[model samples]
Target: MQNKIESLYKETLKIRLFEENLIKLFSDGKITGTTHTCIGQESNAVGIASLLKKDDCILSNHRCHGHFLAHTNQYVGLLKEILGEEDGVCSGIGGSQHLFYQKIFYSNGILGGNMPMATGLSFANKMKKNNKLVCLFIGDGSFGEGNIYESLNFISVFKLPILIVVEDNGIAQTTETKNTIANKIEKITASFKIETSILNYPDAYDIYTKSKKIINKARKGYAQIIVIKSARIGPHSKGDDTRSIKQLNLIKKKDPLIKIKKKIKSKEKIKKINLDVINEINKIFNFKSQSYSNRKVSLQNKKNLILIDNPLKTFDGKRFGELINHFFHIIAKKNKKILFFGEDIVDPYGGAFKITKNLKNLYKNQVFSTPISESTIVGMSSGLAIEGYRPIVEIMFGDFLSLAFDQILNNLSKFYYMYNQSITLPLIIRTPMGGGRGYGPTHSQSLEKFFYGMHGINIYSLNPFFPLEKIYEEAFQNINPNLIIENKIQYNFILDDLNNSKYKSLNTKNDIKNFITNMSLSNYEDDCRTIICHGGASSAVINFAYDDFIETENSSRIIILSKLNTLNIEEIKKNISDKGPIIITEESYKSFGLGSEIITTLIEDEKFKGRNYMRISSKEGVIPSSKSKEEDFLLSAKTINKKVYNND
Candidate 1:
């Protein structure tokens, strides 16, 4: 056991040396991107990871080379990834900061982002009754985020089989631990009433011993937290002052490697250990150098590509309630994995909006009624997705989305990319948005704007004139994690042309192509005023010019942007120049909203010199319930016309 412990310590030391060489590679411009090194904090990562089973899930922070080395021997994948080789873990898309492996929940760049994610993973493991534990390695600094406390509190309440390993390295980058963390981290677990343990660092055997017991307990039926007091010998990053000369000298004195080395008795035994470790390093270095030849590895293929193109073309001219009833009718016949979950959504009563009208009769086990926990709704949906199930989670109203923001931001949005696209989070979080039915501020809102800029999420927010079959197909695509924000106003809306199935005659792919092409060909001039908009009121600007635009010809020339994120630069350049001014209108608030992004981009574009830009958005406040109140505060065609016409 002592010899095995010494071997593990040498493995960790190799990782330290590997990172040091990687830093040199970064300095010499051999590496393209950034990395977070763990030079002194190896003992905690190596010790805890050594106890994990082969199938156990591991989540780690940005400082993850230690985690990668500790979890699996995919060293070639790790090196190729850092070097931006196509054969890399993320196919060179995600760099050193992101090392995702499907076999293990490998890495993340966001601080404290994986806490809730690991919680969701544990939930999935428990639901399957799979006797496996989910482990999360977090830094002392990440514990400062509010989401961490929320995740811990929820994990304890649920008694999920999760092991939270807090790597207490005594510094938040250059800031001392005292400045950031007010209370000791180990004590915080008690406030949540969780089982906790403090481990001695620089002892692989000790960590492995304690972790084995804890892992067994968690796997059976409990949650645990392990706190390890580790050191940060290296800089916070390659060029950081945290690894300065003074710090370097201090690190050498406290080297955990020296401590482990002195314990070994036979000189001949030590020589054999060094040779074995050196051979392992040579294999990794050689494998990484040769990994780029024929790398055609893609974990997720375009599963439903044709289906996304040729959506189901059927929409009965029924009321909104009837259409949703029909929608559920078809969903019941599809597959078992497609599940419906929400507060009021059950078998007979259907859903709060009667959207899930008769799912119980056909697929009784699929439909489930969950507690009124909105966070759990989103979080559990993520877990279900990870377990290879498709979940259509309904939050009763758009306002309730705020309650699930942590789950949405932390797990739902990031799972696919964070795991290097190995996992397909084919989830649809449905909610009724917009205001009119007088449900007050706590029930009605169009909140897709909140998720617009988040790194990993794709927003498919639209105000379809009515129920479009193509929308359902887009929502079910396996490659995309979708947020379908349905407008309450258009819930029961019926398009006359669509009712005749005229859309069915047109090729679904052609329709999208024609729409995008025609939108690009729309008439506009450099001397005219350009207005861009989306969601509910976008059509008003397209078919009918704003009421106040009572006079300007430029009002007719406003180019409507359908794809929210990928704004058409060609169309903008053609229509917006030095002679023209621009205005962006949306139903979301101005701060961190779509309108602000457009205006900022336009003003900064040098080609559009002397162009005046403005954003017509919600008057920085919550969504009001009354039509009259919302109309007074939010941007509508009338308000947009007034703002632009008034400015002109």
Candidate 2:
């Protein structure tokens, strides 16, 4: 008991002294970005850290210095991170607010943002049947966030092994929590049927003792919450103190460090521990000064970075929607690790478009119907993927994908690079795109172009030649986050071979073709125009202009692209004839769209420098609900025919 108490005191003191030094450093202009100090609330983090096993995962909020210290105990590395040195934890890309270390510990600046990630980690734990728990630490300020509630509801329904620790310090930067929070934490969590506990004291030992039982329950498939009533002695960050002097004084009186010091009784031991902590901190400064010059070269080396390249597979014929369902059924049967999550994706409803019809009934344990929480759906799936499960999440529409953009951008796309590529996130985000459905501006949008250049993420579109089942198989095997863009208009189209004497197919059944790049030539004697299209636009162009290419004396070529990002520009350049005018068509907007990228690539190449290029895309406006207007809004073969024959 004495040893445990002494260790708790040491941990709390280390966090306190680390922050105190950081406060001085920030004042001295040594640290760059704003730092959220957890000076008075050290017990909350320390208490949670006590019950955590080495393999247990933890996600933290903006005020995360203490949590990082508690889990890692690498003061020097953390100090370097806050100082933004190249030798820092995340290679200086993630500053004090964002820190990822040891693969299991992650901290972000966004409030309540990591909740879904924690829930995902727990979901992974549940799927693997691993007796491990995921702990999430958030401030009272995060209670108002809708994602937190969504995460809580998910955790409750799934019965995931997760522990949520809310450190209620009564204040959020400058505003009181009571003013912002609608209902009490206990009552709100209880409504979800989650087991909740509130710790009103500010003592480390007290916290440690109370948290063990809750954590144990959590590890055994019980999602629980522990609200620690803490006080903030320091301001939220440097130069941001709004609390009165009296309030600060009262907070200092109940400081966890002070309360723990009273129990120690050995002044000599306390003095020695404080001296050791100071020396440890001093070592950080010495190391920082010595390694400052070499840090940049070390960062540039880029160790542990992973690259994904998967080959495309060919399928003969099938309807787009039915093919997708068949692909899902095959992958679900083959890989037990593949889990499907989406809205209305059960047996009867079979997703918004019936792409996942009967998947839930077949794979009862693996397939699940998620609530209308797009952010949580993506975030939690990311967590599940991180823990070695292949999670395929479906967004009802491409437009709603914006709601989950933060998780897709920050967590899913960046986790591999941010963590030095030590982790593989095998997550597939499948959503239907395009504007021919007459569902109006919000529902019918060809938004795949918006996510084109995201680092560490792969994007694919369904094409007529490539097998959808094989695409899913290759996606699962590659171990990267993939975005499969399904066009709404192509859902009912019959995918079959385009056999013509003039046009030669670039892809063969057994040949090694680029994942999504397919090309065919139209033998015309005079014209040398090359048409590049993808997804819905490809179907439109083929339907409208197939006969024009065969009959005309002017020969042209069509290139079908399914993979938008990491395109094979060299391969694409090889197919085009010398000095041919290129026309790139897309269902998305013209500005900053896929067509723009293709044009830029063509212009940059020395071979295609003098070639005439044009882009055929939808006008930069919303797609109306009327069927006729929607048809006019999207790029079609008639537009291509006019561009080619009439030169309109």
Candidate 3:
């Protein structure tokens, strides 16, 4: 242990020197983009990193050089990544501000934001029974984020196996932490009911010593917090000239390296340590730098058939039991990469909806049953995606996703852009949405629009039908966060009979019973003029239009925008180009919703020539619970048709 400490001291000095050199390079304009350097606080990183196990995960803040190098030997790869080299972790997309190493699973940059993610990872470990600990390293400044408190509160309540390391450097950049943060570190953490340990991070030996014990306790299912008090000698980043040259020079005189080396007496020992460090640095630099410069991302084949099968195809319930059996079999066969988590979301019980019934039986380790924690359900999905798994997590009901919104919006949504596209959050959040069976407003409402408008997210929000095969295929192959909203109303909807025993209900027949017949057919007549519709409401509108409304040749056409974001602009242009009348309809409210966005898009589109378009949408208020009220104000076939034919 002494030898290890001594060697780590040498490594700490190496990190200091490396950072100093990188600062010089940044000043000389060799390194592009801003960087947060970890020069003054070396021991905290080296000490804590040494205590971490191989499979354990670490989440770092913007000042991450020390933390990153401490955890993994991917030094050259990291530097190249910071340098924006093509061979870097994210192939030059994530510059120094966004560096990731899958082996160590470390993330650099993005403020104190990784805490919730780390908390979630611990939740996953517990559910998987993997006995892995997670370490979250954040600066004193990060304690100000609301998510940190939320994360701490959750870890305490759940007793999640995680280690929280707060690097209490005297300053958070130019502003001292005391000004911004209200409570003492220990006091703040203790208020959340978390076990806390404060340490003076004066040297690498001290950090390694305390971190080992804390990490051990966490690995054994105990949660802990290690407050490391240190000082920053370097500027917030390489570019900050906040400290004059004279002041910087004076601070450099008290560098951590000088402090550590002062304790070593023998010149021979110093020389040996110096020589070993130089050799190691050179080896790491040469190998990693070159490899990262030539690295390429291994992406799934563009034409892979793994995504071609649809799980919803089984919803066509001819023989409900057989259809359910075939649904599980198809998901198991097609998306071999899909991972699931929920209570009894496995064989025999598949799920409350039998969606994952046979998945665990076939996939074994892939599909899993998790503890009853919605936060972990979302959090683990984020971590699993970070580790390169195409995880499709089910949150029992749409209402439960609210429990994991921190992991969803803060950690998952912001990862890509904050890291400059360094990480591809290839994940799918599947949940049943909509109200018809009295699940109340919470379980029934479509919440996809909330995520649809979030920044740093290009998620696909889909509620598919009939062409389930095509939708499923596209969803899996597309490398982005996909939110598939399964209409609970269709769970028992019947399909034609197929002769196959496993999939007798899998007959491929498109029925108008619950479908929108295209009104765009040439020579079709319009008695009711124009009808605007979407999803289930549209299905009802189509039948009403054909039955009651008169059909005139060369009349109005229909616009089918399945994905709300990619609202078929071409179709909108075509509809409004002839100055033809239109009716814009949607289930959401008129306030900044799908209908609003569509209206704005149309007004901005040059093809729209002052056309008279009536917007038939829910009133700008809270959604009414009663079916009578919903039918009266909110969008429905009856309301939509009545409004469209009011003056016709």
Candidate 4:
């Protein structure tokens, strides 16, 4: 018993000394980004962390230095990481907040964002039946975020094996916790029907003993929350403290190190332990290390998805939704890592646009209906992907994607690179976007333009004219996040309607995968025009080209690009081989959209420098619902003609 107290104090003091060194480094401007250190609250990190097995996952928030050191003890790596050194853990990409260490430890700076992700990690462990639990450290300030509650609801409902450690330090950064939260943190957690415990003492042994019991309970399929009422002795980051002098004095008295030190009688042993910890920390500073960057992550316990070379012959007048279902089945058969998540994406209801219809029936263990919490649903994808499950989530409508924007931007886009290429996110968000259906203003908008230049992910626009199976097949191999935008009105259209119907055009294979060109049957005359568009505007552009050719004997080359953000300049130029007037059309508004990007790039190309290019877009005011102005909102044959001929 005496040895345990001394040992715990030694570990806790190691963290304290390490954090003190980091503060010195930050003061010297050696650290690149902001940092949050757990000074007085080290006991919570050490106590709960001591109970965790090596395989048990640990995720932390901004104030994570103690939690990270307590679990991994990679002091030098943590210091180098904060210094932005290439040889550091996460290759210096994630810095102090966003971190991943061999899949055992993960952290992010976002206050409430990590909640759902850690829930996903627990879910993955449950699926694998690995008997492993995940511990997530969150501050009291996290209660202010809605997604935290969403994550709590998820873990509790699923009976996931997760231990949420709340380091309730009385104050949230500068503001007192009482001023922000209406109800007590325990009451809110209890509302979710989760088992909750609270402790106000800083005894490391006491915390470790209690945490072990609760963690065992969690592993047996019970979600738990341990609230450690601790104190913050240091500034939130670097010199940001606004606490009163009395408050600071009081916090010092509650310091776990100080409390536990009083229990030790041998002053020499305590002094030796503290000196040894500092020496170990100092030696790690000189340790040589190599850099680890983004590399191809192997599929977890599953063979890589192989692409069959057989030509797709099934697009013989099949419904768009059925074709989507067929494609999803093919993906499911090829990749075991693929899991489907969305609201009402079960057997009978399928999905909002019937894209996932009968998917659950086909892949019973892979399909799940998520709560209407978009952020948490997306956050789950982030965690599952990092843990080696490629989750395909449906966003019901593209408009609601805004609700999960933080997750998409911060979690999905940042995880791969931030973790120094240690992980791959085969996370795909498939959603229907467009204004053709009268679903109202909120549901009928194309928001893909908003995510155009996000570095780590690719966006694909599904066209009825293109093969659906081929797109998913390519996306599966990419091993990154893919946002597929499907046009709602085209869901009922016959597959390959471009060649089978009255639209008689030539299909030219392009360099980019699934990106094709439809050339008018008329000869490529000198006066031909080039039309750049996607699925939503493909039919309208083709019909307009047919009539324009008939009237003026001028043929049109229509380039339909599925890869929205990643434009192949050379392939695009090949399709626009003839020096003709260029026209870009989009179902979305014109300003700062895909059409603008296309036109802007086309004009910059040396081959089309002197060319006349115009962009046709839907009416701005009619977006979302605008039922009375549906014609104006949709990019139709009339809308295209008015924009093309009116100016000419």
How many clashing pairs per prediction, in order? 0, 2, 13, 5
Off by over 4 Å in 4: 285-303, 308-317, 496-501, 507-514, 523-527, 550-552, 622-628
Candidate 1, 287: how far from true, in Å? Answer: 6.4
Error of 3 at 166 (Å): 2.1
Best model number under lDDT: 4
Q: Give the per-residue lDDT digits (tens) of candidate 2, residues 451-507.
A: 888877788888655555555655665545898898887888764333543223232
Worst 10 residues of 2 by lDDT: 303-312
lDDT of each: 0.68, 0.78, 0.64, 0.80
lDDT agreement of model 4 with the native: 0.80
**What are the TM-scores, per candidate, against the unseen true structure?**
0.73, 0.90, 0.72, 0.94
Q: Per-residue alpha-carbon lDDT of model 3 for 1-648, expressed as tens digits?
A: 547656777989778767776777687887888888888787778878777887787878888778878887567766777677766666676666556665355564656556656765776687667888888888898887766776676677768898888888757777778999998999999898777899864577666665666778888778999998776787788755476778667766655566666667677888888888887766655554354342344544432345444444445445333454465467656665567767568778888778777777778867877666666556656666654556777888776777767667766766655443444666777776555555555665666566656664443333223454454455555555666656565555544422333122112223222222244433333323455555544444444444343342333445434444344555545433243566666555555666666667777866554757777765555545677665555555566656666842
Off by over 4 Å in 1: 27-29, 239-255, 282-289, 292-334, 339-383, 395-421, 438-445, 449-458, 461-469, 491-627, 631-648
**lDDT by residue for model 1 over 1-648, one digit each (tens)?**
767767777777778777777788889998876888888777777787788887888888889888887787667788888887777877776688666776475567778766756776786787678888888889999878766876787677667888888888778788877688889888887899888888755556567766788878878768988888777877788777645687678656766666677667777777887887777777776664464432333645645432322112465545554565566667656666677777778767777677776777667777766656677667667666776667888888877889888777766776676556666777778887766566767666678787777666555544443224455565566555666666666565554434443232212111342112112112323225556666565544543353323344333344444344335455555544334466677766667777777667665777665667777766677767777886777656666666766842
Error of 4 at 419 (Å): 0.4
In candidate 2, the residue pairs with backbone N, CA or C atoms under 3 Å apart (3 or more residues apart, or in different chains) clash, namely 524-555, 527-554
What is the per-residue lDDT of model 4 for residues 1-648, given as tens digits with 9 covering 90 to 100? 778878899888888877888888789976657888888888888888888898898999988888888888777778778887776777777888987787888899889888988988998998888999899999898899998988998888888999999888878879998999888899999999999999886668779777778889988789899999897899988899988899799888888778888888899989988889888777665555433332324445443564743235543436776777777776677667789999999978888778788879888989989888899998888778777787899999999999999988888788877776667676788888887777777888888889998887878888766666567667765656888888887778775565654564454444435366556545444436788888677768877877776778666778888877576656777677475678888888889877788778777877678888788888776464556677666788888888877852
Q: Candidate 2, which segments miss by more than 4 Å at Cα?
A: 266-269, 283-317, 477-480, 496-513, 521-527, 550-553, 645-648
Model 2 residue 50 CA deviation (Å) reads 1.0
